[model samples]
Target: MPDRLDPKRQFLADLFDAAVAAADPRRILQDVLPPPPKGRTVVIGAGKGAAQLAQALEALWPHPCEGAVVTRYGYAAPCRHIRVLEAAHPVPDAAGIEAARVLQSCVADLGPDDQVIALICGGGSSLLPAPPEGLTLEDLQELNSALLASGAPISVMNDIRKQFSTVNGGRLAALAHPAPVLSLIVSDVPGDDPGAVASGPTVPGRPAASAVLAEVTARGLELPPRAMAFLQAAAEQAPAAPPPSRSTTRIIASAALSLDAAAQRARARGVNAWVLSDAIEGEAQEVALVHAALARQAQHSGFPHPAPLVLLSGGETTVTLRHKGRGGRNSAFALSLALALEGQAGITALAADTDGIDGSEDNAGAFVDGASAAAMRAAGVDPRRLLQGNDAYAAFDAVDDLFHTGPTGTNVNDFRAILLGELPDG
Candidate 1:
């Protein structure tokens, strides 16, 4: 007979697998495809999922189409007609600059007869870098570094980014105006705002330039002079044109959809699954504490759900990187959660990114159990010190509990699960 799998552990793993499946571009594309235009079709996108979306489009497209998409290095998809360009993400690089040039040039000459399909998801903000005039790539990079470390919400970050970009804020779609643009999106933001995804390369939203300035000043960020001037100029310009009239956008996948799928899988396995807010955000450590409180509530009061329940949540959380750590927000959340639990029996949790890369680390995230604290103590790893250093990767690595799932070829955000009560008897 096969070795028996722990029911609770198996349920959690299955839930994660289901969540990953829900974000697959191959599946998502099938549902959102518009009919092939009688005119020329051009595919352009940027994000961790761009290449995968490009590949899927190529596979499903019945007519001949051509274009290019940029994705992070090592995230390239196999394609023939559609060029897959690898670019830097979370930070723009030379590759992204060149890729942006290609993107701009692709639609520059298109007429009304041509159609553009923009496959946008997360990370497009950095990958589709087209710095405003008088600003070099370095200036943008410096500003991006500050923004990433600022712990600002995604909305604020994108608002600041729009002023300094050549292609963002619906400029890309504007470039191809008169050409019908269809955007198939895999939303990573809480509200599924298309304008926020990839900074609204295809969709447009008018967040005031003054708002960007206010946010930067409020955060006490010292932006490069050129960046500041760009924001000031944008504030003066008419609001970013509304999403192109020629553009029709559709959200094929989102974090909430994936979380719901996970909950369904848990129910099938005879476990009560409750979906917490799919828009949960904030400091990673603080979010863990909140989750820990929920776990405690379920254990003691059972207000949300009774014992033998699993709490599922999906959202992109941030970590103000104060320490020179070797982990991402998900791992940091897991480590902090383990500390808060303090070996309280009957709780097991896992936190991992849907894209299979958490923060800048290779591992997706980490897992923790009621005995995690004791295990760390026996291993001579100081959880508090690790948490202080933001070295959640090392802390979890020491106990061999880091969750590694490589690239899952999709991005919806973070998926977390906390299981309560004893494992079902075999």
Candidate 2:
């Protein structure tokens, strides 16, 4: 590839790749070792990165091990001893229910002499769904659909999920008590709060069910009767998560680490890299507008430094789906920013999920340029109308700018970068 290609475009792509690589399970699992116990070691986990993490453990662990891990469909990796199971993500399915059963069975026989390495990451909460008492999988499925459509933040959504699942809310750790657990996490939540990541399958902390119900009700979400009953029962039995014991909890990867790696890559490519924040949260469109304002300030006043700088950020932003949009929050943010930029010259950006799936769409996110408005106009696509419908993926696809990278097998939330200058012409 020639360096003469638009710097704004090239820098954004490079930064996204750097962020994805930083969250790769192979790289993050190297430092996670506590010497295999004398007894058998069981590897059980669930997430988009669960299979890959299991594979890494199989490759690196010195002792004999056996277990199972469930990952999102098509995200599984080859592994011996640790069986890899595929399941639906963003929704609980029969396969997920089966995998949860297998996970429970894997730990059922372990005693204090045994060790359980829980390879947790984003999507695990849904992937390992074992509905709580008085709740059926059908009820869970309906509640999950409502939450996904509600556009609640991941923290709140996971809080709600923890209340309905048998394996979440530190229940997994409680179930495997006396068997020293080592949780190696790939954080996808803001602040890398273990309790919020995959509903803290292994970590020991959780909010009460009433608090979760209050948030859901406040958001105007209508829960199914069975789900409501389950929540009511849970609220009555609401107990805080147990204190953290000797179970070693380690955050092997997170948005901050991914953002830092991206910054270094931008600097290596001779672009000044500035990470705005790793804990960004809010509605996707609003977040995009805020970032656009900062970009405009950097362009006009150079308060945050001159052009040729790449602004980087990592965080999971939500999209309240008022309309029947066909895109994820990352793409929504990109489209919102593109419209705000309104053909401003010498600027290009990309927003993508590190897990390689933005929302329910196949593409990670989308790329936008100074010419986006012009291109959309020429294509007869109204950006405002699309934004209103929450159809950013369709808008970007029309412009041939959707960035697709199938299932990177990791999730650290979203990676975004904006480039603010043109490269030297060839």
lDDT of 1 by residue, 58-114 (tens): 888888898889999999989989899998878899999999999988887787888
Q: How many backbone clashes does candidate 2 have?
A: 0
Error of 2 at 2 (Å): 15
For each candidate in turn, the TM-score is 0.95, 0.95
| Model 2 per-residue lDDT tens digits across residues 111-134 | 888889999999988898898667
Clashing pairs in 1: none
TM-score of 1: 0.95
**Candidate 1: deviation at residue 270, Å?**
0.2
Q: How far does residue 262 in candidate 1 sit from its true spot (Å)?
A: 0.2
